[model samples]
Target: MSHAIGAPLIWWVSDYTLANESALIVGDDFGSIAKVKLESETGLKDIEIIQQNNQQLSVRLPATISYHSHALRLYQPDLKTFERVWLNAPKIDWLQGDMGVKTSTGQGWLQLSGKNVDTLNLQDAFLINKTGKSYSLSLKESDPWHAVFNLPKQIPVGSYQLKFGQKVTQPTIPPLEVFIVNQPTDFQQRVLNIKDFHQSEDSIDHTIAFKTALADLATHGGGTLYLPAGHYRLSNSLFIPKNTQILGDGNLATHLIWSKIDKQESIALINLEDNTRLQGFSMYHDDAAFGINSPSDRVINNVHIEDIVIRMSAYRGHPTSEMLTKIYDQILKRFSNKLDTIRLQANNITLKNNDIYGTGRSFAFIDSHGINIQNNKFYNGRRGWYSFSGCSEIIFRNNTITGADLMASGGGINTLGNKVSSRNLYFANNTLGMFNGWDREAFTSDGGGASYFGHVQSHKENQLLLATNLRSKGLRLTPYEGAVLFVVDGKGVGQYAKVISMSENLVHLDRKLDVALDNSSKIIICPLQENYIIVNNTISDAAIGIQLYGTGLNHVVYGNTSIRTGGINLLGLWYGGYQSAWYTLVAHNALYGSANTRKFNPTRTDLHTSNITVEARPRSTDELNLVYGIVIRNNQLYQNNGVSIIGSQNARKNMDAIFVDPLDN
Candidate 1:
């Protein structure tokens, strides 16, 4: 039993809802955990417990074990967050015994047992954990279902595997993420001020001083170029250096106005190459603006971009020949490799808590290896975020953009490339304007949302002052649930949550995946991009949930449910080419149950679609209905409208193949 009172109490069995209320009551046993075994789909999802109350003690069943469609051989204290794994041998376990073992991977085996060695075959399965470690049922005398696992100190970030056999595969870019550090072998913090450098009265030779500052930043001996609360006009460009910080006085009054004449990102652009940062400054450009723009391979990696605002060039239409030539000569010709916004050929870019606006024919673009654009706002812009050729891995969490319909442009977050396992992108807790887009948009089953992983809230964790003022105190927004059954870590350590908790949580990889269901990381797509698995995620304000472009084979859309204009619109799988979309199982979950929200259909205002999306603004609870799995079951549908098991030609070819039992209620 659970109690919903002053504190919180959790129970193995409880009820959950989709309202703005607490799903499960967290009683005084706040830290207590418990384990519950469910046989059917609906039973598995009967309750909506946010966290575990009592420790779950899972004792292995006596000996003989039966094979299942998808077994919880390895516990990943996360939501449907399993490391993609292909079994090399038939799984082995016990029905009811002390324990039976199955060699799941090279280093690990599914340890199943109870009181005896070989006897009573168990009926159900259970998994639990903390961080780095996972194992078979917890059979300790005192506790049964839940047992917290210990994790490493500085646990390695990024995705790894829990092999079920003897293969060591990898993702799109196991490309080493090398953090370019400062010179002298160690990181030394240097600080500069507006008084340290300035524009000459004539503004000519003053440009020389600007070059000196730029050269210093380009070199090593990392330092900060601090600007007090005043406007420093630059006749030429202000350059960026490696292992350095260009800081501001932390006042809204602080301003750095770039020479609009340098619109081509010449004097206005900030170049980076390993270990670079830009903090606390309002960059006002006359023509166009740039925060950090480096050449190919040259990047500002392993750094932070906090409390900054960028204003782009606002030329009405075209520029004068002189201005264009000057722009080309001063900017383009110099660094044509640089894109419209910034270019980090091969680096890790984290753009957090910043304000960016680009009107006219300008947009913010990225050409990096791993890019994280989070907790930011965009006013009136032609484009917001884009993932061009070189970009393979990306994460966008808690960001908001206003006028996406100002100009005829591309997507808000465009992640497209022909490369395999290309972009391991992530989108959580982000909000987007529904009826907004520069181009004529199309409506689909989902809201405009197609972001990789869905979540709630459109905000980011910022510096101290911002944190104090920005985040709401006692409000816990809707987030990913379910699948935390595989507890990787406990309260702290390297505890990763379920990756597939969100109805939109999906993982697709060429290699076998063995991850915790409750995870907060990116997914692979092809060797260029592939590992994207979605589980119990929610998406009410989206147009389309999951859209597959190329061949989707052996892909399982397990336990993912969403809502938008229609329902889920499956693409590409129909026609050939990438029709390799096989073994995809979209099972036990909820879909658009909001018949009323359908009212937005005829009155739907925003409809522009993009690559991937999620709800940014903080919401009451996980919105939408109670549908699950990519394979919609006939019996499940019957629960709502009692329909018979039937499939169309295309549905039989795609959905039916993945569906194991459509008739079973």
Candidate 2:
């Protein structure tokens, strides 16, 4: 069969011979084995090709190999034509887990055991559902004889085939069954009706009865507290305890209206503790109060807030032109002290399927981790989301954000503050629309601080002599080792080298410099962080589509469509005395810049006035900044005001930025 360019042709294993530690392979017409690769469940390793022919190849398998499923991939010298053949498939053993019940946040594990199971390449393994949807499985734990696979969350509850290479294992004997329940199992029973208490909508002091019911549930083991369909007035905050579930009839049916007139102090209407679930209710606020707060004390963790609607306005009556004007002037103005709709400080929190409207800030995460905010909607807010301090492993996906006002510094999403660094933060498959805010940029991350730099006094034999003043600029010997250093300005511009070692005033690199360096040359170093993916998103009608400032590593932004907006903007700043935002891939995006004069006004005219801007310059005049390993390719930019690729003054001096088919207008 003829294959497309760069496509690997499938070659099935016709015969296999394993004896006396020697291996023989027979497959369809591979021409010759220019190179051979052995893939096991644990890892992939190159095998020396001892013999080769048009239809047969032979090599010595690893001594550790035994009755386990393995794969042999053959490649020609051109490295384009290849074939993957599974070996020792029939002798492998698969261990299936028992039928299990998993919550939406739960995980499933399946095991496989065989001889030399530790040698398997688990990264290449996957689970295929009956509908042909495949989910990649990771190696949860492994020993020499056995390996466990953690099922991905994207896999739904169904029968699936455990596949590694060409070997597929069907469900065995009892048939593995998995069911994913949306709500907690304890919430299914033991409901406390709020009406049973003496809480009424007419009462101005409704906190007394509501607190009584909450304390009553705390006295016993916590369960679901059911709020019936009614307009419930709250004068003060509601504190939720651990293991408690607060469920209402529906978002529109059950209303929790905040009538508190005190604007001096801020408070959360519902302060959640660990393992708490709040859902199916509409929260209305008048004064500066947060709708929900998940604080980061050790007592609070694993919180789930979903199926709720939060509105910043208190007037439940129909809106009139005068009322909206009063709201815009009195409530949402610059002087208004409105708090965020949700302030998340806890870990392992999921906010899903929620609606937030007309708030100062929709969501904020401070020093949190493992946060998944998905399938939500935000409208008429000041800011869509914010992450302060350090956060990791956070995801914002499938959310629709629109109609944000510029009263406060309005934008779609942002991360900032002192010592703020975010790793593994992904924004995927989201739709952002028509953001009219003071800060017109849709997305931004500002790692605020001075950039780190060291002067290269001289270069000799893969070593660059650093100036003595490097230590004064926060350059430490230990951390400088193994970090990537870029030569900014001078003859060595656009050249980078990895630090192999660092001495008192000299830095050794992995390779010798092709050009000599003078005292005027500057070097910038950035650390390594891993795994950030932004894909399949649509953004429109904003000043800037996406912006990353001084904080990113191993990040990918691909397969997105931006309409009538400024293209992606990247600014590498110095944050906490370090250079961040390196190793980024921006590709396969369709960006359409706005031609409208009012919408496409330049925010920073000092920089290049272009649709797509990448800047890596000094924070002030004295400091130095750098962005490394940025690849921008395969992108379509239409009506971009005749400028698609524009770098600031010193930004293009450090790295060779790649722009393929950058502009169409």
The lDDT of each candidate is 0.35, 0.59
lDDT of 1 at 465: 12
Task: Sum up the clashes in candidate 1.
Answer: 164
lDDT (10s digit) by residue, model 2, range 584-631: 666667876562322344674432222655666445454332654454
As a whole number from 0 to 100, the lDDT of residue 647 in candidate 1 is 27
Number of the top candidate by lDDT?
2
Q: Estimate each model's TM-score.
A: 0.48, 0.62
Query: Per model, how many backbone clashes are there?
Result: 164, 7
lDDT of 1 by residue, 1-665 (tens): 13222222211111111121221221122332233222323333222233332322122221222322211121234333222211111221111110111111112112221111111112211222234342323222211111111222232323332222121221121111111111221333555554667645655334555567656655646666666776766665665666777777652867766554455555335665566677788876655445456654344345457788877654434789886556545544443423354434545556778886654322344445555566886544443323344343444556654444333222332223322223333333444333233331221211111222222222122100111211232221123221111111212111112223222223222222222222222121112122233333344443344444333322223344444322333332212111222222334444443222212366565533322211111112322111111233311331132222222332212221122232332
Residue 187, model 1: Cα distance from true site in angstroms: 6.1
Query: In candidate 2, residue 268 scores what lDDT?
Result: 73
